[model samples]
Target chain A: MDELIINSELHQYKIMIGNRIRYDINTLLPKTYSTILVITDDKVAEKYLSEVMSNLQAENIFTSIIPAGEQSKSFALFEKLHTEALTYGLDRESLIIALGGGVVGDLAGFVAATYMRGIDYIQMPTTILAHDSSVGGKVAINHQLGKNLIGSFYPPKAVLYDIDTLSTLPRSQVRSGYAELIKEGLIADEELFQSILSSDLMSLSQDQLHNHIRSGIKIKAAIVEADEKEKGMRKYLNLGHTLGHALETTLGYGVLTHGEAIGIGLLFSMYVSESVYTIKLPYEPLYRWLLNNNYPLFLEQLHVNDLITLMKTDKKTLNHHIQMVLLKNVGEPVIKEISDEDMSSYLKQFLRKLVIA
Target chain B: MDELIINSELHQYKIMIGNRIRYDINTLLPKTYSTILVITDDKVAEKYLSEVMSNLQAENIFTSIIPAGEQSKSFALFEKLHTEALTYGLDRESLIIALGGGVVGDLAGFVAATYMRGIDYIQMPTTILAHDSSVGGKVAINHQLGKNLIGSFYPPKAVLYDIDTLSTLPRSQVRSGYAELIKEGLIADEELFQSILSSDLMSLSQDQLHNHIRSGIKIKAAIVEADEKEKGMRKYLNLGHTLGHALETTLGYGVLTHGEAIGIGLLFSMYVSESVYTIKLPYEPLYRWLLNNNYPLFLEQLHVNDLITLMKTDKKTLNHHIQMVLLKNVGEPVIKEISDEDMSSYLKQFLRKLVIA
Candidate 1:
């Protein structure tokens, strides 16, 4: 299959999506690096690293695998990666390949970024959920206090998406990954959302899955290209992320996959959007679709006040004011500067209420 | 004294050195940033931070201070700076000002470079020793096994050197700072070496100190401008650093300041240079001068084999081959590819004699 391209205009890089492209990593690696360090998690490495390694038969490749988990993206992990990289004799002329999902990407990108001021890195995302997280070059790791509290805007040399790897993804991850696709559509492509909602998502053929991932990536690409540093238009990409990140942080990460929290947060935004905007959304149908896909819309088990407190601590908050991305409808998002008073009522009374079919 | 101007061609930044320029920080701050975060150490905060804060009087100026030590410049510290920058409401529109010596500069520069990919930073170096450390924009921190194991080559927007702060420097620090001046003269400027050797460095007139600092900075700036990422010419700057950093790592930091370690390392290099090159050097005179100045050169009590083992792990080593910058003679340096055979004997026999001197 031909690689689908997501061009980020600001940074001037392309995200290429295809199947089995991990076999051709050198085509993307910059020739300047004398050595290559492949950073991966234990799970991903055990499953697929040898395939990635096979491509660089002539090159010097070093692999450092950490235990697979969000917890691995810690100071201790960063220190280990630094020591191992040095022990393997990696230098400024080395290329660090992040060969797993978001945790690996964030930690590895950070390691590469700060390794010698910075070095080159190629994103070889393995998880189905990494489809959305892998693009836009926002590499970060969770802190003790919050998720993605530490990171950099270090763009990858190129991103290689191998669809073949997604075949190993568990069904739960497939559902989780769909939330970001839903997000991409909600932010800019209403037609894409309709197509996804109307389709038999679980039974998608390889070609169908590739197209869906590409479309979602393209939507994200356009936004990032317009505003690479989240100065303006890129903020729109946080459609469900502001509330979603708060929910993830409050609930504690690793408990819920990122997309799952955003799935719940996406429904909450629908309530805010319906009340505050002119666009009329199919709220009941959308909620039903989320339920059908196994998303928890009413997070009653989570303390409402705690979520509010977590939202206040969000990186998106300015002067303690919650800045929410409220959708005009299914396809359009408008950033609403919601007052704390109105946000609490919106979350407690309306967001908690569910339309059970 | 007039401010010195050194244009770094590699990174393309103009370094401004003067006395009390912290009073004029607003002029140096790039207009691109809407806000600024000042990254400092606790010790520096107690010493010169008030002046730095007062100069950046804008309401958007925020300050975050970490513990004052080399220990604080870890992966954990890097994460804290990243988080605090976010917590202080920093965005892409923000700038980070490093208001201390090498530690603050390295950590803050790494933070700015990695926070959201990269941001702008200004170096307000307060120490007299920072005359050499501040320029070239090589920001880094220590790892467990070594110093500056994790870092980036992210240049600051500008460096404003205020000489007035040097008045507060301890006497030991002033002597330590002059080692770089001697280093500059040894490698590139014969006249600079003679001038330092002839003069009483213990009591320098303000103008004299400024002239020496400016000359050293100009040399660093010229080299950095040519090889910003240390591809070739910048390796010369690591003359003492290879063995020096090893010494510091082996003996443990805090036991010896960076310049003190380098001072002894420089003497060691001189011995190596004498063996490999025909260049004439007054090594005995220089050693006497350093001893008179109360410089601590680790000798009899320290293990020679341990230091050599540490040197093997130095970043300057490639494929187990130690690359060293040896003085061809006064004012000329030749980067030699040293063998392990020569390295072992040079430390045991020659270094033992020098230490007894």
Candidate 2:
């Protein structure tokens, strides 16, 4: 088993990664909670809830099963979970366990963040995408207008990443999850990025997948430790998310998985970086890699103006200026405010390139 | 203007107290926000919205006015404010000004705490009751089941308490606001408590009120600074809130203003303290003062079992044990876990005492 410690201003917690690490959950807990509330989605519950519950030894145990998907991260469900916690008599000494992917982690983490003005929670990420969401204390529910529009930076007590859970993820989910690992590489780790470019992401050995996930989390942990609140260097983590979130909002959530949308966004960011900096980049090689890996690289003929409007509304946008994280080079990311005219022109150019590629 | 600095783990901000300090809002701002969203209730908007808006210098400014009172601190208004923020193109660099009493401060502060994973917000308290809420950073929206069940401990960039705004407050509002001042005294300052006991709470001169409010804030500021997250000494501030919140929830929120309910909770804590510690207290004097000041001193025909149930569900309750903040002596508070059996009998005795008094 491998463990990485994440240090934030409010907390310091461990991210334990290994096969069947879920069973060792008892060891990772900061203390024995009087009651334990495990929040998972219906899909994950069907597969792992019983096993996790049996392993979790607490005097009082309760489980809230939300419907499986991005839609679960809504205000209604967030309230429902708090209602459940209250109904079950959970208190300051109680603990919450988020036992699913990014959706559960974000929703449950958010519930823990605000429930009784904060409580202790642990992240048991069942999917690869959660590797990114789980480490940082950024837990939130989506508003009708945008994704993660309501949330806070509250860290978890611990994160137990059981690799055994990943064996059940669909290929699309794996593809979606890998996009974040690719983001970690593009922003800060050239060797990791180069390794991913050279390998078949779908057919990675258990050891290879484990190593990459660890690398991604380590990179994320360092950035978060330095800037827990996203005041400065943390913007690098949003390298592809500026356009990535717009695509998710425009395409309608769930049409493209978070990572799938980010895959296309990663390509767009590189294309814009190359143009804005007038520097040579390995754009064609990366494009071919995404296409070869079956990442949906097309924008579905969406209007550039609509995409620009969505980008302008992103949380990262400052003063209505769309701040896109572009690569000064691989292993280096810089935030640049793209003017509407420049952004419009860049979108047109990128769309043209996408069609030709 | 009197300025008090609040230092927390994540932030350090000033609480400016004086008459008509709202007009100097520009000088208190940390920086020029690209846009500003002023969140106030309909009632407050009618009285002070235009004036606050005129004083607020920003390129773009927007206002969201919910219906007045505690009902505004609901999930619906919280969501509505986020929608307004997104629609107004408010961003990370934007500022949210909470321009009302505790209701607006809590709802708006919560919105700021979560919008785009938190933006900057300042408290412009227009009511005396807000002297407590505005400084603490305990921002939240109430759930259907409990008060402040869903919230976070997010401090504001600045708190501008304009004593001038209190001129138009109703007698009920004034009485309600003073309960918190009484609580600060009961927990930390005997002089403040004795002074309050002697004064006609309904008819304090401006200077007396100012001194009392300043003293209450300084007491609160000291506790919050020592324990920002309420892991220790901060719970002392909840000397009355355990039962106080139960009263509000039991009677239904608008029936008795928060401070009025807390006033009763304060008496109950004293009675419980006198019994549990086998000590004499100034219960008679405090009780007489509350009665003379027209603060509602009775619980109407509510069952002890129901109130006990409510108290058990309080956020302070640990492992299903009812934790009440009781006075060891004047200005010294201690948390005690009251047995359900003892709690029920105490409630009966307290009810009987109220009837006789």
Lowest summed lDDT window (length 10), candidate 2 chain A:
A21-30
Q: In model 2 chain B, which range of ten residues has the least summed lDDT? A: B311-320
Worst 10 residues of 1 chain B by lDDT: B1-10
Clash pairs, model 2 backbone: none
In model 1, what lDDT does residue B120 have? 78
How well docked is model 2, in DockQ terms? 0.85
Q: Write the per-residue lDDT of candidate 2 for residues B273-328, one digit (tens) a residue.
A: 99999999899998888899998886679888888888887778887788889999
Question: Could you say which candidate leads in DockQ?
Answer: 2
Instruction: Name the docking class for model 2.
Output: high
For A72-171, candidate 2 gives per-residue lDDT tens digits of: 9998999889899999988887899999999999999999999988999999999999999999899999987778988999999999999989999998
Q: Candidate 1: where are CA atoms >4 Å away? A: A1-16, A23-35, A58-61, A282-285, A327-336, A355-357, B1-14, B24-39, B54-56, B60-67, B79-96, B115-120, B281-285, B301-304, B329-334
Instruction: Write down the TM-score of every candidate.
Output: 0.89, 0.98
Instruction: Write the residue-wise lDDT of candidate 1 on B1-357 in tens digits.
Output: 344444443235657877777788777665645577998988889988887888775558889998876677787788778778776777555689898877888789878876655677888887767777678777887777777777777678788888888877777678778888888888788787777777676787888878788888878877877777777878888877777887778777777777887888788889888888755677888888888888876454667677776776666666557889988777677789888788888877666786566
